[model samples]
Target: MKLAELEVNGVSWSPTKASLPVLHPTTFTVGAGKVLGVVGPNGAGKSTLLRLLYRFQKPQTGYVRVGGQDIWDMPARDAALCIAAVLQEQASAFGLTVREIVRLGRTPHRSHYATSGARDEQVVEHVLGFLNLHPLADRDFGTLSGGERQRVMVARALAQEPQVLVLDEPTNHLDVRHQLEVVSLVQNLGLTIVVSLHDLNLAARVCDDVLILKDGHPQGFGPPQTLLTDSLVSDTFHVDARREQLAPSGASHFSFSLPN
Candidate 1:
């Protein structure tokens, strides 16, 4: 259930000969029950790294491991069982109902042409309840608004019962409240999560660790307070990160100040 000493080395992905690499050589590790925040500019390969780790594409070199075992060496089904991904584009293309789409999360555990048993149903119910999706469970997937659809995707991923949850731009279409709710749910799950986020402040609030990427390479990696500073933000994001302290808890937050 924990990822210890995880590393990705010499990993590159190129679709065409002249096409630039999606992910250049990158290496980093995340511990268990901790959230890793990935931040970068538009083309920093944050999504590419998530794809490589989730086996959407094979790495040209190096490795991805879970618990000291090479992920590629593990059976694909087994890997799917342990790692659940909630990608930005995983919308229901088939017009499936919300509950039905979420139930598909159990596919990795199914045998040949098998149906979901009572346990799978229980998990699906649990996930919907956890995400507060019971009110919308019977809705058609395509009929939901962007934020609603996004929550459905999160529920699906949670229904898989994975130890490691990977989210790529999960808050892309969400409003402020939904964003906080979805992030809170993920944080409370106590799962090893690697979430690629464009909003650096949200990352600081939700994640325990951080990895900064620029042009498909690592710019920095560490705790949020250490990595989310003014200089690094200015360098990687080309903007100043101004700090402010919140009330009561007095937790620090940041704002992006534009260049003159």
Candidate 2:
């Protein structure tokens, strides 16, 4: 499925009618079936952009659209059906079991207070299996480790079967193995994945394209190989790329030099 161009028109948000300038009235497009990394320094409007996409906050001056359709114009449920998000914050668990938490994703497809039908059950099972959460399906939501909890959140999002999956720092608390597993799974799914990442190397490995946000505006957006150059990494990310060649792997890897 093609990701309709993401159109943003002078989108800005402010509190108390005074502009905070999280996003500086920027406009851009993120293509489909590809992962776009939103990378920037702290407080650069990463989450704000995500909130705008999910309609968690209204824009003061502009609009956001998918498939040429205004995201706000569509019903909230419809938007939910099209996009799922895994944010970088804790969600209060209702003391629900893991299975029950995942099953919540079926809500949009079901009537109010409707039971889980056969297809819904199958989808839930599939998601659990995909995320290797089947073992913890019966566990308490609050008891899982941070990585496990993150995986569960992703599983719940996957259960929505959305065209676009937006994650904010999805690898934050995971060990190396789980981090790789989750990102690789996302890649294999071929969904239009828009995620904010702090790790440039991980972003390079997973995302086909990258969107750099600096000072709450578009710095660059293109293929990783094209946009993730040594100079760009040094300037935009404020880190030096120590380029080295791997003897066995025969590939170049970058290490960051700490700032003076």
Write candidate 2's Cα lDDT for 18-107 as tens digits.
656777776666776767788888877888888887778888878888778888898989888888898889678879889998998888
What is the lDDT, from 0 to 100, of the residue 123 in candidate 1?
Answer: 91
Clashing pairs in 2: 3-32
Which parts of model 2 have CA positions greater than 4 angstroms off? 1-10, 245-250
Give me the candidate number with maximum TM-score. Answer: 1
Summarize candidate 1's per-residue lDDT along 1-260 as a digit string, tens digits.
34444465667777765787777777777777788999999999898889888888788767888667777899999888778898988644587889998899889888878999999999999988887888988888888877788888877887777778899998887888878877877688788889999998889989888999998878888998877888888889888768778898888888887898
What are the models' TM-scores? 0.91, 0.89
Off by over 4 Å in 1: 1-10, 16-20
Best by lDDT: 1
Model 1, TM vs. native? 0.91
RMSD, every candidate, angstroms: 2.2, 2.3
